[model samples]
Target: MANTVSAKKMTRKIAKRTAVNRSRRSRMRTFIRKVEEAIASGNPNEAVAALRAAEPEIMRAAQKGIVHKNTASRKVSRLAQRVKALVA
Candidate 1:
């Protein structure tokens, strides 16, 4: 469909970027899932540790444009709250 050489080149670049973004997104979700699993297990210490590990990953995802900045912050905030509640 891309008739121009430049357009074809852009398509290829976009595909490559898409794969990279998908990988980063998957990695970020895995981190979030780990935190959720820790929370579900009801171990306050483990949950806190998982959150600590995930917060940076989430922020990094935001930095990389995989997720919105506010969304990342809100997610971290909610996870922290849950961890605190579990601790209490």
Candidate 2:
């Protein structure tokens, strides 16, 4: 229970932020899934295009604190590697 006025306001703010973050996180995952699907389908062009779209979304999620910076970079690296392998 938030008794203080400031605490109550903070709680409300937190709830709003939580909803926004959840939406952003879900969107980021959707982009990642798209990239994975493109990769799994084994079309180099599609995979490359999907990666191009997803990379920025993943990085944005990290920037917004939804994921760690290192985790974002690692994910991008692995996905890029897979895409490269598919191309080769």
Best candidate, lDDT-wise? Answer: 2
lDDT of 1 by residue, 1-88 (tens): 8999999999999999999999999999999999999999999989999999999999999999999999999999999999999999
Cα lDDT, model 1, residue 48? 90
Clashing pairs in 1: none
Give all candidate RMSDs, comma-separated.
0.6, 0.8
In model 2, the runs with Cα more than 4 Å from the true position are none
| Lowest summed lDDT window (length 10), candidate 1 | 43-52
Tens-place lDDT per residue, model 2, 1-88, is 9999999999999999999999999999999999899989989999999999999999999999999999999999999999999999
On TM-score, the candidate that comes out on top is 1
Every candidate's lDDT:
0.95, 0.96
TM-score of each: 0.97, 0.95
